[model samples]
Target: MSKSKTTIAKPSVLSDFKEITKMRLALSVVFSSLAGYLLGVETVDFKTLTLLAFGGYFMVGASNAFNQIIEKDLDALMDRTKNRPIPAGHMSVNTAFIIATLFTILGIGILYTINKQTAMFGAISIFIYTCMYTPLKTKTPIAVFVGAIPGAIPFMLGWVAATNDFGIEPGTLFALQFFWQFPHFWAIGWFLYDDYKKGGFFMLPTGKQDKGTAVQCIMYTIWTILVSIVPVFGFTGRLQLSVVAMVLVLLAGLWMLYYAIGLFKKMTEKAAKQLMLVSVSYITLVQIIYVVDKFIR
Candidate 1:
């Protein structure tokens, strides 16, 4: 008798983790948190750093998972999101729900170990992102404003995790990110307007790719640039930015603004994509500059 052939199972654990966390997006959120923590803490504790990293991962993961769950149907409609685990049938809705809940609980518990305020912020981010922003995406363009609240929390959450309080330092970090999100997200909305339209998501202020929406994008980009340079005036308490760092950040912001202006003038998908890429680079580089300035100064 011929022996039956055996089939080996593929290694799926890592893939599942990546899918559950939306690792790329989670990493971006974690980077902002790390920058805030580094700026806030005079002396870094390895244990605290580890906890913050893990806590941020879980919190962002939970938010993304819940977002996917809520938008699964819409995801199916958009080419950009049609292949996500839930929408593509790689994961069941029930499984995704349980995973999201578990991650949220774990994230809050870990943050609570650091501080109650951090935990509260983590919970609030999840609540606002999942309950309010997710549903509002299809209803009104104001969802971006609601989403910015949660998006801005991670930056300040890091400072709270380090200091266990809300103060000028954390407030500044929050303000910087809060202003940054509008331009970053609006740039993405501009490029993905057709895709978003297919999914019933209204992301532009004017609900169409018109001068009004482009003008709003330009206004937000200007605000982001202004807030990014605020630290140069020594108004952010302990979160001061050196003149050199401020100049560097300002130059980067101007480059980003240039792309935003190009998008406004051309009103083409390519221009919007360029603006989106530049906006991402601006935020990431600004965070790095802030942390580096904190250490150098």
Candidate 2:
């Protein structure tokens, strides 16, 4: 009697790369970094800009990969994250860990070649995200605040990479991103409250979606809007936003606020979802406005 042997296939390198990086999220981070670079640089340096883009992607990808690795068990328990590469068995923990370490090293090395501060910030972002924020998610609702620190670093990191120093310009960038994160993340928390609760993650300040959380979202959204327009008044000094840009940004903020208010009034899942979508649009559009304003003014 003869027996046939079964062949096991290996995963493609490209697919593995995408799964580890969470390509879509990485791309979004890269886009924000590009906008920061454009705003920070008075005259475009194609070579430097390219380096920042690649470095930003590598750093953020590593952070996200490590986050998935740490939360693999919780991810499997949550409906929203059950299909993630780590949770779904698309990649092994050891393989993901190796990939994350490689990315962190490569990313920091690339940024260090450009300048030391950029590399330092890259390392800090990874450490805060993976080491502090990942564990805090399961322990406290304030994790969102702690997580926002590293989450908001990419925009400012790009500016520092361009100038190789922290200044009013980078400070302004940091402020804009810092305030924006609260509303943006809260909206997501509101929408995914049930799923997060299931996984023992405390995302909302109240740990329950209600008027208080929605009101906080609205307040933060307003603060972000105010900060976005402050550059127009010359108060930001080197990072001034123009009148046209200010008007455009204010409109976007109002649009986002409308959704936030609607969520407060209705307090329904549909309204929460709408606010979440609007928050995403608001951040993306505001970043574009900042970059375009730099060129126009």
- The number of the candidate with the highest lDDT is 1
- TM-score, predicted candidate 2 vs. hidden true structure: 0.93
**Each candidate structure's count of clashing pairs:** 0, 1
Model 2 lDDT tens row, 1-297 = 001111223444455568668888788888887887787776788888888888888998899889999899999998887766677666789989998989998899888987999899889989999999999999998888888888788888888877788988888888888888887788788888888988999888888888899899889888888888888888776787778888999999999999989988998878988988888888899999888778876
lDDT of 1 by residue, 17-113 (tens): 5876799989899888888888888799879888999999999999999999988999999988886777766678899899899999999999899
Model 2 poorest 10 in a row by lDDT? 1-10
lDDT of each: 0.87, 0.84
Error of 1 at 266 (Å): 0.8
Lowest lDDT 10-residue stretch of candidate 1: 1-10
Candidate 1 Cα outliers beyond 4 Å, as residue runs: 1-13
Q: Distance from true position, residue 277, model 1, in Å? A: 0.7
* TM-scores of the models, in the order given: 0.95, 0.93
Give the clashing residue pairs of candidate 2, or none: 231-241
Give candidate 2's whole-model lDDT: 0.84
